[model samples]
Target: GLPKSMSVLRVNDLVLAAYDSGIRRLEPRNGYSPGQQDSQQFWSAGSSKCQGWDSQGDATYQVLVQEVNASAPQAEPYYMQILKTCELDDATGTVQIATRCSLNGEDVLHYRGDQNRWFSVHPAAWRVAERWNQAAEVFGAMNHLTPQQCQSWIQSSASFIAQQTAQPTGHMALVPRTEARPRRLICHVTGFYPRPIKVTWEQGEQDALWEQLSSGILPNGDHTFQIQVSIELGQEGAGPTEHVCVVRHSSLANTTLRVTWDSQPTVQTVTMEIVVGCLLTALGVGALGWYLRKK
Candidate 1:
């Protein structure tokens, strides 16, 4: 078995990498678009999903190369982290890295169990929040995130969300560079109309407070315009609740993008398990008492 301490430390290191560098723009070196290279970076670490031991008394371990967003041109774009967890099988001492590909727009497993399994994860996946534990530490270091980093996160978040919704456009945020009580959120909104639009905030169903909007026109180089707006929610209550930015476009329906930042509670849960010996002892005592009563 792997030392628990070493496993924990390895996890911490990966999480720190996630925190210091948002996972989206980080990607693996293979099967990626070079055009997107201007936006991502790479990090290598060991995987914690399994230990150095298996049921058959074989030693096994994995190392992963993770690709995350680097600070770049946009504050944030479609961000992602691709992990290729490679394992060394002690039985054969063979090293293998998992690989995946899309077949007709669907991810299908094609390799053998013995081939290898690189756990490909997306920020949009289920375990993302939990996978974020160590990385969450750097999120608090938002002040250290450069403008390039912010651009990467926002742009990447927007792109990914849009792809999921098939909307072709939307907005997202990267942690901001200030230490306010509620945390800072910077967003970039994209759409097809390419005209100046109204950006305002509404909390839950109530009217919005702390509203500010700035607008500019960007060239798409395709005879189209890219409209950009910036607003800050530097106020109380903006934290610990859900806030929606209602973007009224010149041609599209009023699109409402929501953001929520409730502080994660700092509580750890522990479960106590009894040993088999203790269980047998309790059962023996119960039987003994029953026998004495009968006597």
Candidate 2:
């Protein structure tokens, strides 16, 4: 049954909730120089139907990329494609490499290479094709680039931006581990470029007294970065439950950002649950005492 108040939910909210419960969780224009216009790029490559029990069986593979707004300097994105074949099926193997120059979604050239030889949509692109072939940069190019390597560019790009371009911003949160394990206080720092950054847990203004549980820096996927520094709460925790996520990054020159979390409904909710449990236990004990007295 739905709640009466929940009837007000917008259609979009219901649809999103369904996906979120299961944990479900375009391009830029062309430019004169690489910097003039915003550009968006996507590249993905993978293989399917890898196992073939017999020579008569053929496996399938592919790589697909849809790109927009790469018109100038970067207009020539090096590309090469290769396919291998033999007279007998048992002896047959295939190679595919594709790289190209593009403008406004139009192909400047598509270079498909076989062996060391290459052919291009534009004859002048042959030289670039040869270079890509020699370097063996291809979609799903097992020899030159691995599937992991092909897909890692996006993540690496984020890491690069975090380490080279932005500054760090941060805050702290209470992270409750398993009930049996120690709860931890975490300092989260994100969105600073030039990822050479540090986050420490501090009490008041004094230097951090406890060792940080290193939660390595990770990319936030928008040319930004994030990292977590944590400390486990022991039986006899030190100083204040009040703490700070001390942030240090290139963006903040001679400055550190210290952020704190609110003690909100989280405290109220826990207290309420404890009170309810205690009340239920008292009722049970009273019921048992009455039963014994009646007997």
Candidate 3:
């Protein structure tokens, strides 16, 4: 099964709702304030599910909430985080739930669902971890509720996930060389989703085996990805050769996207040639007119 995860983001004292994977699944307009009707419905559903889980055992989920509120520090500039991840081992038919907490960018506590225990990540956090572990409600939910939520969300969002992929756009350009480097042919692919993509330089029918450099896949502000692969152009090449940049991505699985680049005259070079040709033609016509006048 594919790995699944959920994250709740908080900044300072304001608590926001959770997200499935990276998509914003549920969030309120203001801190704990009622948002849209659908968002409230979703939150209510999750709360009811928690209550149902609490009914199955002696520990109530409210204990976990109260413990969290009581454990929060009163100091300013405080930060808290909770991350839950679930992974399935296909070979053993086993699922693992990993839950952890951080404070002020430092790991403070972690829960071992397999062992049914919460442990301090550092010696300084031992007291805090021990205090929180006393609330059996938290660990039980971390152990059982997380995997179920992960699986159910994945199944329900399968079609939505498939529609999320964004196809990449690619282009090729010849860049001027520096004093220490040779000219380069750069292939850039951008605005792609899912991040996993292949950008390679090819010469005619085969992969270009020349020395190349790559700007590894980088995230765009809009959540898409981009990459650039470049190969140095050597002076030893006899003539212009057609080179192509090939991009392979899940969004373009059915077709390979290619952007081609070849040696072409620069705009300045073409402009200079046209100016010189015009000047030569003017000089030749003037000379012919003078000879005809002399005749």
Reference-based lDDT, each prediction? 0.32, 0.41, 0.57
TM-score winner between 1 and 2, please give it.
2
Write the residue-wise lDDT of candidate 3 on 35-138 in tens digits. 23365677767555534433332242233323444656445543344555566564764667766655444565677778767787745566656765787466
* Poorly placed runs, candidate 2 (over 4 Å): 1-165, 177-179, 235-240, 261-295
Per-residue lDDT tens digits for candidate 2, residues 1-295, read: 3211110100100110111111111111111111322322121011111111111111101111222222223545432222121111214333344333332233434443334343444434444445545764442332332234423332333332333456675545565658676767666566666556877776766766665687565545344556667777554555235667778776888888877665423644544643553454455434323221222
Best by TM-score: 3
After superposing candidate 1, which stretches have Cα over 4 Å from the reference? 1-168, 177-182, 253-295
Error of 3 at 97 (Å): 1.9
User: Best by lDDT, which number?
Assistant: 3
What RMSD does each model have against the real structure?
25.2, 22.4, 19.7
TM-score of each: 0.26, 0.36, 0.55
